[model samples]
Target: MSLQVIILAAGKGSRLGRALPKPLTELNDGRSIMQQQRDNIYEAFGRDVSITAVVGFKSEYIVDRFPEFNFVYNEQYDQTNTSKSLLRGLKASSKGGVLWMNGDVVFDPIVLKRAASIIARDQSMVTVNTSSVSDEEVKYTVDAEGFIKELSKTVRKGALGEAVGINYISSRDKAAFIHNLGVVHKDDYFEGGLELSIANNGVLMEPMDISDLYAVEVDFAEDLERANLFV
Candidate 1:
């Protein structure tokens, strides 16, 4: 099975308080976030995998930085959310299983490799990395069998797991899913669209618990500091 990787880097990332786009922000090691993510994908899937980046805010910066990878511009980035950004990326991706990921997080290459293995084994399955989350953040409720039951933003009464911003989706199903996604509320996030599809179509998502994986997502200055510590 062919594997394609799509990195969503179109957000303005106002929280980062940077002149450049979030993905272009430099890390402590001097490499930009986009470069780190691209390198991570390459390491995980080798050179065979087709990699594409969805660009919008600061698109020129991303194009200048990563000339090797194919880029799809999300013109409605400011008007829409991650779901639209994902739709733009999916439209540009090759017709096969894909490793869809968020660009803000720095992940271990092994996570991508593991997800690819699962997708290759079962095309119907979707993989989401689960990690212990704080009480203030949105968390996903998973059943005993590891299927996502609910993706809630409200603080739950019990334990909850956070999505690590990585996913493995079959392109055939993804296209159909995106088509159905158009019926959902426009302001809903990409995850919400997936949840809608899962609820109505019985699409099964397998959990890949990566609580042990060393990954950092740069959302604010504090997150950047935390990333330095982890890196």
Candidate 2:
């Protein structure tokens, strides 16, 4: 089976204040953020990958720009959060493991390169940046076994790092994850699903630290500025 990849781009990124979908927002390099992500995916996985984009909020803009990607639409985009959009993406994936990320994140292509070996082992994991941890970003903490214990923006007490919006669910854990994600509130981010899966189903995930590399989740204009610095 081909490697399955997902890009969650269903929100109207009002913070970035862009007329285009946030993923379609152009970087200093001239390629749109999603375009760069697509290029990087190709670089890491070669032509055998199956890329799926979950689109909403002027979906046409993204759809037209990347026709090569398979699409899953989130009709309730305005009212729902990443959990719902990601659930849709997960439901659309074929059997086997899947890697997913926020469409707006701009990162060094090597980030995906590093994930390749670990992914080949079929271990579920979330890429994290230990160098930065803030209330605004999704934070994570591990249990005694060092598997991720808590994951959310509200995490504070034992936060080890910020999730970089890139994550993988192994085939062994996919069904439980999909079910856990289905129970999350519509307003919750997908982190809630991971947490629920861990607690409710004992799914274990390692935190792959890529602190030395750059991965920016472009939530605002300032974030884009920082992302461009590394591009």
Candidate 3:
């Protein structure tokens, strides 16, 4: 089966407060966050997988800087959250399952490869990259079977996992999923819709533990510095 990737790059990076979008923020390796993610995905999945980046905020800057990667623009990005951005990319992708990821995260290529493997084995499967939770990171509640029961960045209880901002979705289910996604509350994050779909619509989700793998996602200047050290 062919694999496709949808990179959500529309966020304003308000936490970073940089002139550049979060995706365009500089990494320790001197490459932009977008460049690092794109390169990492390509390296893991190769040319067989179709990759489309969903860009907004500073769409022109992204297009001009990385002309090689395919891009789809989301005009309403300023008013919405990640769910909308993901829906836009899902609509534009070709007929195949997709690997959905956040533009702000930095992760090992092995995580992508592992997710692809899981998706290949089961078309209904969605994968979440998880790690040992820290006080500062977002957390997830999983059932006894390890399926994600709930996810929150701020919930104080029952949080044993952290979402690494990666997911897999089948093409056959994309339309229905995206349509249902349109009804999500405006302020909800992309994962909110995903958790709803998994619970209410019976979407199959799997977890991939990546505690051994290390990558730094930049949400603040401190995180940027951490990423520099890891990269």
Candidate 4:
């Protein structure tokens, strides 16, 4: 099936303390983080993917910067979080398989390839990294059958590792997935909506281990520095 890619780039990235929005931060060889993601997706899926980017916090700059994408502006981005932006994007998404991603992450193209391979078969998935675990991470745990049991920042132990903030939903599950997202309060993270869908809606985003790949979400100033080095 054809795929639609939704990139959430609405936040101001205050923790990074950068003039550029987090998504537009130059990370690798002067290419912005979003550029890298777009390039990687193109390399992985080629013409099968269409991109819809949700932009806020200098929305015009982001829109103008990436004219190739279909843009949706989050008018209340200052008052909301990723979940709200994702809901908006879902309303704008076409009917197909969807790859949802955060804009702040920089990752190898192989990560997209790996995710695509898994999603093609299982239809729903979340990319995971078992190589690094931090107390502050939003960890995802799986039962023995490889089904996701929980996803939260508070889980301090027995987590495989952090979720890469990349998720896939098959076209068959689109309506239910949107319903799952819609029931969430605007204040909650997108993950909260996602968890709801898994428990009540049966939207199974099984964990796809990608510990061998290099990926990093640049949240803090130090994370940005580390991302540049890692990329």
Candidate 5:
């Protein structure tokens, strides 16, 4: 089946304190963060991959910039968070497995090559950065058989690392994920859905560690600097 990808770009990104959407923030190389993400997706999966970006805050700006993407507008973006935005994106995507990422992430293309193999096998997985474990980012711990168990910022006990923005859901698990995302409370991150699916639906998701490759979700000035060095 052809690849379907979703980018969750519906937030105001108030943390950055910028007028522009976080995804549109310009990198040192002159590419917007979303544009760089698009390039990375193309490099890994080719241009034919079907891409849908979920837009809400400043939707028109992102919509006009990337004419290549199919957009799903989240009307409640201002009142909600990633769980709601991602629910819309998943609903808009094809029935096949979908790969998605936070629009603000700047990642190396090599990461997606590994995703390709997992996507081929129709296995669900979340990409992780084993090197850093910050209190602010979503952290994770695997279950007994190596599937992701607990995933959230609250994970303080045995966090393997941060679940770096990028992730995949197989066709077999997509509906379950969608259901969980829908039931999650507003303001909950997308990780809440994943955790729910794992706990409630028996979905098994592997953690694909990518600490060796550079992937930074730009949330602040310091993160943008770190992302630029690798980009």
Candidate 6:
């Protein structure tokens, strides 16, 4: 199956306190977060891999800047969260395996390669980083067999690690995945929707342990600075 990379880049990023949208924020290497992500995907999956970015905050900037990739505009991005943005992108994607990533995250291309490999067998996969578990991050608990048991920010104890917002949804689960995203309230994050899918909607979310790879989600100015060092 063809790999479809869906980038969720719709948020205004109020926490970052930047004029540019979070994805458009330039790193020290002079590439925007979104640009870096696109480049990494291309390097790992080759140029034929389909890429669709959900654009909202400064959507025109993204459209004009990255003409090579496809875009799905989130009209209510200002009023909604990542869940809605992701749903819109998912709807706009082609029928194939999906490798979705938060546009704000910066990581090596090896991470995408690993994700692509997992989606080849497993219908669904989620990246987990045991090293970065914190109070602020979304944590997950796994069964003894290593599947996700529970996932949330309030999960304090016995968690494997934080969900890095990079996930793989197989072509087989596309309908259920879309239903899961649609059921989630617009105000909730995409992680909340994923939780609902796992807990209630019966989505089999496998965890891809990525502690060996360097990955960081850029949420703050400090995070952007750290991501600069990463890219």
For each candidate, what TM-score against the reference? Answer: 0.90, 0.99, 0.90, 0.94, 0.98, 0.94
lDDT for residue 92 in candidate 5, whole number 0-100: 80
Residue 53, candidate 4: C-alpha displacement in angstroms: 0.6
Model 1 lDDT at residue 177: 64
lDDT against true structure, model 1: 0.73
User: Mind giving the per-residue lDDT tens digits that candidate 5 earns over 1-231?
Assistant: 679999999989988888978999999999999998898889999999999999988899998999989999998989998999999999888778999999889999899998889888999999999999999999999988999999999998998899998999999999999999999999999999999999999999999999999998988889999998987
Q: Over the stretch 1-231, how does candidate 2's per-residue lDDT look in tens digits?
A: 889999999999999998878999998999999999999999999987999999999999888988889999999999999999999999989899999999999999999999998899999999999998888999999999989999999997989989999999999999999998899899999999999999989999989999999999999889999999998
The lDDT for every candidate, in the order shown, is: 0.73, 0.94, 0.76, 0.84, 0.92, 0.84
Candidate 2: worst 10 consecutive residues by lDDT?
Answer: 60-69
As a whole number from 0 to 100, the lDDT of residue 91 in candidate 2 is 93
Q: What is the C-alpha RMSD of each candidate to the true structure, in Å?
A: 2.1, 0.7, 2.1, 1.5, 0.8, 1.4
Model 5 TM-score (2 dp): 0.98
Q: Which ranges in model 6 have alpha carbons more than 4 Å from their true place?
A: none
Winning candidate number (lDDT) = 2
The stretch of ten residues in a row with the least summed lDDT in candidate 6 is 114-123
Instruction: Please provide, for model 3 over 48-100, each residue's C-alpha lDDT reduced to its tens digit, 9 standing for 90 to 100.
Output: 66778888887888888877778888888888888888888888877767788
Q: Which candidate ranks first by TM-score, i.e. highest?
A: 2
Model 3, C-alpha of 159: deviation from truth (Å): 1.4
lDDT of 1 by residue, 134-225 (tens): 65444677666767766545537554567677777665567666775576655656777667767887666666767777667678899888
